[model samples]
Each structure stands twice: as C-alpha cells, then as structure tokens.
Target chain A: MAKNKTFEEKMKELEEKVTLLESGEVGLEESIGIITRAAAIIKELEKELDDTEGKLKLLDLKTDEITPLSEDEA
Target chain B: METYSVSQITKKISCLISADTTLSGVAIEGEVSNCTLHSSGHLYFSLKDEKAKINCIMFSRDVRNIDFLPEAGMHIIAYGRVMLYEKTSTCQLQATVLISSGMGILHEKYNRLLKQLEAQGYFDKEVKKPLPTYIKKVAVITSPTGAVIHDIINTIRRRNPTVQIILCPAAVQGSAASGELAERIARINRHNLADVIILARGGGSLEELWPFNEKELADAVYASTLPVISAVGHETDFTISDFVADVRAATPTAAAELVSFPLEHYLAHLSAQRLRIAQATTLRIEAYRQRLKVLKRPAALTQMLAKNITGHRSNLTTLRKQLAKTAETMLIMHRMQLANLQIRLEANDVSSTLAKGYALVKIKDKLLQNKEQAALHEPIDVIFDTFRLKAEIVEIKGETYGEKQNI
Candidate 1:
C-alpha cells in the first residue's frame, strides 16, 4: 500500500463501497471482501490523520530541496 | 550677435534647451500654481520654489498616468524638459511625469499597473481556480526569519497536525523581494512540491508591503498551476496579490486555517459513516430475518387448513340429509301411485268379479251373452263363483221376440 493516495480519495472509496453494500445486492463473499478492504483503508486513513510528528519543514529555495524544520524553526 | 525676429529667437532657445541632456531629463520639486487642464487635454501649470518659478506643461497622455488629480498649491515633483514656447515666447518645462512624493508616487504606479493587469483579465473571477478541498502539503512563501512563518506553522500545527507545511524562505520587502517571491513560486510549480502555495507576509504600511503589489509577483501568483492563497497584511489591507490569488486570507494564520482540515472533524465524520454503514446493513439484514421468521411459522397455515376441513365436513352432512329426504319422499309417492293402479286393475279383473258372487255362462268354451248365441242342440256351460257347470241345452226359455234373456 503506497500512501500516495490522498485521504479524500480513500474516504470516497470507502463511502462508495458502503453505499453498495447497503444496497443489499452484495453476496457473502463480496460483502466480506468489501468490508475487509474498506476497513483497511479506514484504518490507514485514521493512522495517517492521527500522526503529529514530522509535520513542518523548510524548503531550500536555492537548491529546491526539503529539510525538516525543528520546533525552534517554527 | 545676429539680429533675429521673436519667433526665430524663441525657436533657437527651445532648440538649445532640448539639446541639453540634463535639462531634458530634469526633476524639479516645488509648489504647484495656476494649474488648469485645457479642453485640448493638456495641463498648464507653474512650479515654484519661493526664489523663482517655471512654467510647466503636462500632455494628456502623461497626465493619465498619475493616480491623483493635481490641484493648485499642492507640493509635487515634475519630471520633463525645459523648452521654449514659440508662440508665447516663454520657456516651459514640458513635464511628462507629475506626482506627489512618498506614498503618492507608489500609489500612482500601483494604480497604473492595477488598471493594466485588470484590462488583461488577470484578476478575472472566472479565471480563479478553486482551492482543493483537501490540501496535504502547503508551501508558505514568506521570510524565514519573520514571525509570520512561525505563526502560520504553529496555527496549522494546532489546527491540523497532519498537514505538512513547507516554508519557502523569501524576502518580504525591499527592491529585490518581488523578484525573489516570483522565483520561489515558479520553483514550487516546477517541482510540483506542494498542493497549494501561500504567499504570506505580516501587516505593514503600503510602502513596506509594496513588494506584494509588484506586477511581477502578481503575474507569478496568476501563472501558478497550483491554487494560491495570498495572506499579506492585515484584514483591511488589500494587495494586488490578493486579487490575483485563488484565495485571499486576512492574515498568515488565516491562510493556514484555510488549507488544513481538523483531524477531530475527520475522525468524527469517519465514525459517523462507519456507524451509518453498519446500521444500514444491519437494518436490511434484520428486515430479511423478520420475513424469514414469518415464513417459518407453519402453525398458522395448519390452523387455516383445519378450519377449511371442518366447514367442508358440515357441508357434506347437510347434503347427505337432503339426499335421503328426497329418496324417502319419492318412495312414498311411488307406493301411493302403485296402490291407485292396483285398484284400477282390480275393477276390470274377472276373478275379482267372481269373488263378488257373479256367474259367467258359456256355450262350450264360448261365453253366452244371450240365448240367440246358442244353437238348438249345442252344449252350454255355466260358470259360478267358485265352480264351472257343464250341461246340454234341453229347452230354450225366454225366447220371446220382445227380449232374449239368459236365466
């Protein structure tokens, strides 16, 4: 799972899956699969959202490189 | 000395003044007097510095460049050349630029650029891009040493810790600030480093915040591929960057709030969705379970069948009684009819008549109704109630012509 996907994208996917499941057309196997995938995405999104470390950084305009900004920098 | 006419003298003086580079490009600071705009769209005025005065003429084309209207007695700076008016026979400064000093000059330049960019459709509402609903990485272009960056970072850190703030250090003021700001914004676009760019600076006077009003920075904000949020100065202060950006924030901290989402809100929304999904699916399955439960109850069906059987059995009993009653009525009716027929047959029966004491007379085997049916010597037979008598005719009696009788 590359974390490159946006939280919005994952949330949208979860919403669509939930709507389909709620339609009641999903069979036992399909329901299990959707639930599993939706749960995984939700968990991943929650973990990323809760993360507070490694937040601020300074961009070197000359070199165009990124370096983490310490607390004092902020 | 050559003796010359007035027109020739004035032409020679104008030529001499125009030929001097210093006089042609001179700037004079003084008080304005006798200022009037002619119908032909030229301004006629005089600039005075107490000791002396000089006539000035500003053409309409150059007059339109200044932001404010010049009034008499106003102190200002005029830039142009000294030229001799041939018709008036007077030397006048052909002032191409006239503006008040300090903020007045910058205001004029800002207004001129604002009009130019507005005509080019840079600040068009339709051209503005929508800010992304979710901004993950925000590039804040401001001076690194300023408190503005710290305020933005700290505000975003408090509001949404998940959002990553990338500070793009750039000069916020001075002559080189606008160029540096434009360069940094271009670099962010080139690398696609962030989801959105925020050009922010703390509040300052119009002169101190002039870099944000620069056309180069305005153009940079407009040309960005990513959406831009301009947070320059306080709420009351507006800059050209604000007009060109996709969103305008009143302050740097406000910019942070605009681009970041609160984690608590997301967590709450996620929980609500999870609850709703589980509830919806459970409700559906529960409905199906109720239907199946109703179907599984056979006792109601069995009771209905029993009720139907009891009704049919009572109906059969009533029908059997009706059939037996009909058959008995028919048997009695037939017996009465047979008895009536027996009486009719008994009325014509000879044996029944014999039982009534009547005799039947016959001549041999023939029955005799009268003596005329008998021959003279024929044998006659008589039948009584219980026996038959056989005899021959010895005599004939009752042979009178009036009546023939068998006695």
Candidate 2:
C-alpha cells in the first residue's frame, strides 16, 4: 500500500508517524500500528532509491540507439 | 605596516595605481616581443623598446577591435592601462585598443555589423529564453572530433550519470561553420530530442572564433524554442552567439554543468533524510523501552493504574494499622469500665456484709431485709457470717422507734 504512494507523500507520512510515535503519548496498540506503517514507508523509500540507481548511458543523435557509457568511452 | 591579506594588499596597490593620473591611459611605444597568442584569443606579450619590458594582455574582445595581429619585434604603440592583476599579483598592461598604421578598416566593419544587429534587437534580454530547471537531456552542437565534446560529455556524466547527451556534430570553425551550426541547431529543435541545447567550441584566435559571431548563428540561437547555452571560448572570449543565447558558459564543460543536475547532492540529501527518519524512530522506540524499564509498567493504561494502585495500597495499609490500634484502645477502655463495675458490684455484696459480722433475720425461711418485714415474735432465726441462732421477739426497738426506711 505504501509503495503506491508518491515519494513526497510517503516521506511526509513517515515524518508525521515518526513524530507521533516519538511524542510518547500513543497507546500500545497505536504505537504498534505506527511502527508497522513507518516500516512500510521506509521500505518504499528504499525501493524508490533502488529504482533510481542507474548506470550512465549515451544516446546516439543520428540512429537514436542507446548504449551504456563507460568511463573511457565517455 | 598594518597586517593585510594578499587580496587586500593587491587592492591597495591597485587603488594607488588608478588614483594617480600618470598611470591612467598612457600609450607606451615599444617593440613587441615574446608574443604568445593564447588559445583564448588574448595576446600575451611583452612590450620593450630598449630599456625595459612590460607584459601586456589584449583581451579577446579588444582583439576584435585591433586591425593587425601582434607579433614579436613589431614596432607599435600599445594603448592600455597599467594595474595590479590580482590573480598573479603582477603589474601588467590591459590593452583595450591597438592601432596599426595603414590597416584600420576591418574592426570598423565588425563594429558596424554589431551596431546594426544591436539596433535590430538581436541581443535583447527580453528575447532570451530561460533554461529548464530539471534538464533530462542536452543537445550539444559542436565539432565531434576534439576534446571539447569529450569534456562536455565527461562533465555531464560526472555530475549526473544517467542524463541523456544527444551529440549533434557541427563544424565549430571554418568558412562554412556558421551555416552548419545554424542548420544543426534548427534540426535539433525540430527533432525535439532534448530539453536544452549547448552550442560550444574550444578557444581559438578571434578570426578562427568568428564563426560564432556571425549573424546566422545569432538568428538561429535567438529563434530557438528551447533555451541555448553558448560556450564559445575561454573566460575572456565573447561572441554574438554568447549574447543571443539564454546563458553563456565560459567553457564547454561549464555548459554541461549548467544543464545536468548534480546527482551527488540529491543522493546525499536522500541519505540524510533516510538517516533522520531511522534515528528518530529508533530513539522513540528506545524511549518507550526505557520508560517501561523505569516504571516497570506498560505505557498507557496499566502505567496509570499501577501508579494509582500502589498509592492506594500504601494508604490502605496505613488505614488498617490505624483501625487495629483504635480498636485495641477502645477494647481496653471498655475492659477498664467493666472491671470498675465489677468492683462496685462486689463491694455491695450481702455475703461480704455478713462476713463483717452483721446478721440477717429470717422467719419461716424468709430473710427479713428490714425490721418492717418481720413479725415481732414469730419463731425467727438470725444468721451471721458463719453461724445461725434461734431467737424470740423480746424487743423491737428500731421498728417502733423512728429509724427511716426506704420501703
């Protein structure tokens, strides 16, 4: 469920939930609920970062073919 | 002397040179020697007649104003000012204008064309397009053979590894470079392949760098829908393309930096944000654990209940002790009162009175409590503490006499 949320929304929700849990006024069940939700958000954020991790590439202007760009070739 | 930084001392020396009128714009007549035309289109040379030599730099912009090239051993009067160049901390001449005899016509033509273009609003700031904030791809138009393309590519890849670089090769300088550059720019725009365009070339002499100053390239740059960044020469060089483009970078590498986002910054920020969330959550959980340990109770409901119960348990203990003590005291008080009543009952006992040798009078087995109950001469018996005797009614002195009776 949290994976469907945008990065910004997930981050905002994670912050709010963390703050609520940190306030030390939550009930045991609700603390557990916040922990569960926060875990999901952190997982989603990690996945998003993993998805963004990509190698450099070069796109040929003439043929429009893409290829991985090595350091020496670049 | 007061303590000053290197920059501060250089500023002081520069101020002294500019404030004096003699150093203002004096033309020095000398034979030019050691003339090295730097790739940036600026001439680095020394002007020496016979006695002394002074270094001079005619910047690329002023190079366009000059009629002839400055070579070693040329007799000329260099028109410039002498000032402390802060970067090198040396006094040198910044030559703005150089005039040679018999050839002053080309600079006039260039100036004339520049003024005409300016009048036509080709260099208008209002016409300049703004670059995209998040450029996904960059269309670079330059000669593909040299280090300029490699520099641009390397700079972009270093900043953002995943950004698309669409290399649109065009001749950077020649008789035909201007037309080719304009055509490539229009083609790149037509393909709609990139967010921004970088029109670039390595530094060269003013004549070699003249392709970027042509009107066709300027027109193509001014009419581009996407933003254009012109990187024509080194830091001192400026061309007509530089004015018409939205942004002018000093070098090809700098143009690449302008278009590509720095992935390091975002990645660092992302890592820091993740760390903050993790640390904050960990701290909160640890706080709960510590709270549980200190209070020896659950956080929400049982914590308060346990507190109340402990308080009430102590109070109940104290009340129990107080109640037991009060009950014991009341019991002692009642026992003392009972003992007093028992003593009073024993003191008024008839047997004890009899034990003191007083007799009880009885007739026909009825004991007379007072003399009014007795028949005077009935066969009567008298009882003492431990003895009994038979008697007759000889005398009744107390009954006839006035002894009071509670009858």
The candidate that achieves the highest DockQ relative to the unseen native structure: 1
Model 1 chain B — which ten-residue stretch has the worst lDDT? Answer: B398-407
lDDT for A11 in candidate 2 is 68
- Top candidate on lDDT is 1
Whole-model Cα lDDT of every candidate shown, in order: 0.86, 0.77
CAPRI-wise, candidate 1 is acceptable
What would the TM-score be for candidate 2 when compared with the true structure? Answer: 0.44
Residue B329, candidate 2: alpha-carbon lDDT = 100
Can you tell me which runs of candidate 1 are displaced by over 4 Å? A1-3, B1-100, B300-407
Q: What is the TM-score of each candidate against the true structure?
A: 0.59, 0.44
Listed per prediction, chain B TM-scores read 0.52, 0.45
Report the lDDT tens digits of candidate 2 across residue range B1-407: 77899889889999999887767787877777888888998888888866888889989988887767876655677888988888888889888877542123334555776888889998888888888655667888888678998998888877776567777777887779999899888877876767888999999766667788788888898889989999999989888889888999998988988987786665575566566656756777787788777776456557567758978899999999999999999999999999999988976797889988888888889876677766666778898878999988766555443446544
The fnat of each candidate, in order, is: 0.67, 0.17
> Which pairs of residues collide in model 1?
none
DockQ (C-alpha based) per candidate is: 0.46, 0.23
